[model samples]
Target: MNKKYQVFISSTYDDLKEEREQVIKAVLEMGHIPVGMEMFSAGDEEQWKLIARQIEQTDYYVIIVGHRYGSETEDGISYTEKEYDYASSLGVPTLGFVISDDASWPSSRIDKSDKKLKKLEAFKSKVKSKLVHFWESKDDLHGKVSISLMKTMNLNPRIGWVRATDAPTTEATQELVRLSAENSTLRKKIEGFKTIEQPDEEKRLVHILDDNTRKFKVRRKSDKGRWDDAEKVRNTLLEIFLMIAPTLVNESSSKTIAKEIAFEHVGNNWFRTWPIGDNKIKGMIADLVALDLVQPSKKKHSVNDKEEYWSLTKLGNSILKRARRIQLEEGIDTLEDKSEEDF
Candidate 1:
């Protein structure tokens, strides 16, 4: 059975009611179930428990950090912070959208309860990587928010945007049929170019043979041993790299491509992971090189010879096109299948 992607939105209700509604609408438009606190009354303890359950079930947790997010009530807990804490405890992949200076930053600085402001500040620091900030009146709110959500959900941005007018009409049915036939012909020609298995004696180049071998194998299991949610995120990153491979010509450096991907997907946390801390990202790049999706450039250098630049190969471009098609067909289902079992 197909799984629906669930998203939990955490925000201060007083500050972002309108914006939150817009966000909820966008999420529904994108075909994901949006869970927000507005669905329940504040006085119901049972409702809060249900909200926590929803957070646990969510694939992505989106926290909207406004100026008054941490402001406390008589009970000594800010509702926004409480939701964030609960989501973090469940090890959910979370993203934060902070209201920028353009949005009214709270001025009163009132702490109705003890040290609530300080607590909020500390919590913000802890989850800073997931945080994305934007001006209130940005012309492209949908684009910006959608891009950020795609990154957090590990989706390919190219496939995220869908046009209502892209569907074929009765007048264009013949054209569509003709194009489909042409596409099938091209696919056959492409398949013909695939390398066939070579004889053992012909594959004797030691370094080349070793390089072609798989370093690790990931397998799917029916019950146990499913890939974790983090792996799903890694796969999304791989898909994005494949999608952008074609446009990045031989002149484009690895740094340039990485920056573009970061800009398109990274959102407000762009500078947080500078220099690449994770081995997974590095491994993905190595895989790209091995698959000839990208090739090293002799002219470009990453500060020195120790670091090399890479550009996409022809085969890489084909893989990217295929990846986009897969994304369109499956949407976020591919990621959900990989992460659901782990959760």
Candidate 2:
């Protein structure tokens, strides 16, 4: 797995204890690490430092945004919000899971203080692209969250859930695939027709295409703003892998070692990418390999021989440690400022 797709889970303790646990379990089951306050010891500065470090090392920030975000904290800065701010500053991709009132809060009246509400509102506005809403009992939330995460990470969630029993079989899967291909073809034609009759709709489509194209190019360019930001995070994770290499290598394979580092700092999954150009992805891999931070693994014959595997090298480990340090420093700085403001 590449070191760039770590995920950090953030949430207020008051609202999402059991639910958080369940979410963490889901992440682990998906083969990613779950980083939360629970990963650290209680009331220990070292623990706080560790949490901050993990946050820095993470690739994706998963924040569980609930109603009572800041109410429980003496400083009035929800830990979740702090995490989000820190991740944002570091240019990490963030995802917010908003708990549905029907599931987490029985009423429309939120338990947050007025000041906290305003702060949360501002944060929400800032992170609109990375936010998603989920209800407790809604099975659809799983698919929605999965799809959103996959989109953010530039991955395809076509593998289906690990425990999914109702997975489409060979014939059904082929039929669905065929239908989807047909639908896409028809949609493209319809869109083309609409472009002629509806200038406004055509303009919207053009805008969307332009924006997505720009984003895609940004991801490819080494000096592009977003690409640079991602590079910073990638370097950080490489440093972390170095610090833990000795300990991890003794007990695990390179794949497991990379996975463990990703789980501890990012989320469970290590290899995730957005649905972008094949050439761009190949280029990104080449750059990482050239830097000596990542390497392609030996081919393994299994259910799928076409799938290529990659892992971190000793040099990559050093990079991850540096990245984790930066993340921790930024998180602590944000938390301190928020704490001072509360007083």
Candidate 3:
């Protein structure tokens, strides 16, 4: 919808009449309403109140300066400056323009009194130091006002006046507020759902590897014993799993542990002494996770952290009761309880 603003013009009336006229024309061309001291009763007893009321009703304020400082209010500041100050205090969006210092003005348009000249210079300094345009003529000011007002309106729009019938109903506004609150609540609830302890494929893995190298390898019973003592190492590997299953219960963590296993040097042993490298370790943990004997811990683990930890699942715990005793009879023990001294 097209919105029209009411612009309150503030400047010395007699001196910058042509400048003010140009501004008013520009404002009118843009379909905005213009009101100024020229349209009001100048010397009325309640002039300040009237100006305050005008500023209250205005959607914007435009202050321009020339050579002269016009009539002053009881506070000794010019009424034009007073209007600008009042509009500013009320938080009205303001556009200011001033005559360039190099521009020549007729003596009739300037204040000859020393005090008034000082005030005029101070006022011009105040206005020109901020969001102000310096214009040499009415034509320059007209173009400046047109561009400034249009840009200002687009950037800092205000809550403008509307017809009584055009305003939103009280119930409709209340409904809008309620819906806004509900939208916020629903967003928070969705965030909570995302954080719940449920598996998410899209979520990043804690130990993500760019190189998909499958280093860990597990021994299989079905494999033929092509190498020396292959059968013995395979059985020992099973005992190793049963021994470490209680501590390294998660695949990601257990895959990283370097176990020091002590195995009896049996007859015709051709294999290297116990403990394996990366791929063999990972394969062992992978089989455990697949068998539901080991579970990935819910505790947050970082690859940089020493993440060699896990827990036995319910089935693993049940199997452990008997597996521990059987593994002891078969001469298997965790490195945590045994060292080179135990051998």
Candidate 4:
């Protein structure tokens, strides 16, 4: 009987980082899942498809419009507005929060370009056309979001997700059990007769070298004791997988994975500094997901631990075992930076 709704938080990044964090915290405090594009750009068709799919899956959509209009696509529409339009088209129960016009805000956070400012004004107008809340500060936004969401959910209840164990065992479930038993019998009759082959695309993913490598940028301290310019670092999927596989032997939070990677590459002192941004770390994890190596962990955690968790998939574990075997055969004791040819 426990159901959790998923709420999508859409807004411009960097400028609204604190606001988004507060919103996510508020959603989690309400005991629902909060999903967003914190790690994605939503610029390309493929990215748009992913965003659309996520929006479709969410029970409610929350858009926070601040000063910045956000990065635009080729059509000159900001991705934030694009997301709002798509969510509206689907009639997803929406909650809009716009920064109060009279509120004092950081100049750095405001749009500098005349074009972006125009777009921001238009976007705010479009959002204000609907029932929306105005907030002057992050705390104000958090409080309003919590109260508004509770009321909206009461007025517009949604069929959300529940744990498998929580699902009612009804006649359909009994039918499924019967069908599963019949399927098991059928499988026994044809065991080993035909090998199940992976899809060509998935099989190709295993051999594609380009797909196996990802680049991450990190900022290191310069000789003058100041942060130097960011530099690119590339790692093969196998290398990255091995780097974090130990920590992920169990379900580990994304923050934990980032810490492990940072400590391994940088040092413990700088790991806390997070030489690489969280989004870039998530990009690394996303790559593993594309390779079907890891998946989001569904295990319950305390609400205080807001970070998303991940676990190694069965295929990932198999690959890890194989890699260990190869290491043993090659007398490799520890993971070391190797050329692309090594992978």
Error of 3 at 145 (Å): 0.5
> Candidate 1 on 122-179: residue-level lDDT in tens?
7566556555545454223443455456544544221122344765578799888999
Cα lDDT tens digits, model 3, 243-270, are 4543433322443233322122221121
Error of 1 at 213 (Å): 25
Task: Give the top-scoring candidate (TM-score).
Answer: 4
Q: Residue 90 lDDT in model 1?
A: 84
- Of candidate 4, the 10-residue stretch with the lowest lDDT total is 201-210
TM-scores of all predicted structures: 0.47, 0.40, 0.49, 0.50
| Arranged by TM-score, best first | 4, 3, 1, 2
Off by over 4 Å in 3: 168-343
lDDT of 2 by residue, 1-343 (tens): 1222456777666455766666666566556666777776534444556777887777677777666644333555655666677788887767767654446454443654677678877766665564354445424344334435544543322222233356567998899999999999999998888745644432332222223311122222232324334422222222333433433211222333333333333342223233133454455445556656567654354774454456556655554434434436434222234347868
What tens-digit string does per-residue lDDT give for candidate 4 at 1-343? 8889999999998799999999999999889999998757656657988898999998999999998998888899999999999999999988999987768999999999999898899899899788777788998798678767865675477988999988857987899899999999999888857689546443343344224667775555432222355555776666677777755645666766765565455542332345667787888889889878899987888888677989888877666556655555545443553433478
lDDT over C-alpha atoms for residue 42 of model 1: 49
Higher-ranked by TM-score: 3 or 4: 4
Model 2: CA > 4 A from native: 1-5, 41-47, 71-75, 101-104, 107-112, 129-131, 134-140, 155-343
The alpha-carbon lDDT assigned to residue 105 of candidate 2 equals 53
Q: Report the number of backbone clashes for model 4.
A: 0
Residue 289 in candidate 4, Cα distance off native in Å: 54
Total clashing pairs for each candidate: 0, 29, 5, 0
lDDT for model 2 comes to 0.51
